[model samples]
Target: MPMPKTIGHQIHFAKTLSGLIRRGWWEIPEIMASSCMAAIGIVLGIVGVYNYEKRNGDNKEYKSVYMIMRPDDPRVCLLNNPVYTQYKRF
Candidate 1:
């Protein structure tokens, strides 16, 4: 049969656990720092991808001769062209 614990035993156990945590809580900070670094890495990657190909010098529209730079620009030619979005420098 297992020995039953009293209130005093439970209190002592709690006190000991608290003391251990107080003295050796390095893992908590380590986990937090790693997670923060991973998040920073993800944000940086997204920014890099978003800023890629900023200029439209080399970006050419598949069929549209002129990019839709204004509201009056022709859209019939750019309708099926996939490169129309990249053709604009905006």
Candidate 2:
């Protein structure tokens, strides 16, 4: 008889965990990359949440969403300048 899906998954997970515990899993590139990517993703998610809160707080006008692209900005000026647009170097 076949094992139930949940039970099978649990058994597989336990086996994998046990194997990792026995033989330091950090030496494995796959595990290192997975852990690094997960950590980066979590940090980025936190920064995103902080940005959202700051952008949409009670003082919305004080921190306008377009604050990054102020008209006086050099980058914005370059974008608007016809000469810059005509010969845009990749």
Q: lDDT of each prediction vs. the true structure?
A: 0.58, 0.58
Tell me the TM-score of each prediction against the true structure: 0.32, 0.35
Candidate 1: which stretches are off by over 4 Å?
Answer: 1-27, 53-90
Candidate 2 local Cα displacement, residue 70, angstroms: 35
Considering every candidate listed, which one attains the maximal lDDT? 2
Query: For model 2, how big is the CA root-mean-square deviation?
Result: 13.5
Candidate 2 residue-wise lDDT, 7-85, digit = tens:
3323222457667654445347677678779999999999998988776543332333544567677656433433343
lDDT of 1 by residue, 1-90 (tens): 999766542322235876656444443767667877999999998877777645432454454565546646664543444544543466
Superposed model 2: Cα runs more than 4 Å off: 1-26, 57-90
Residue pair clashes in candidate 2 = none
Best by TM-score: 2
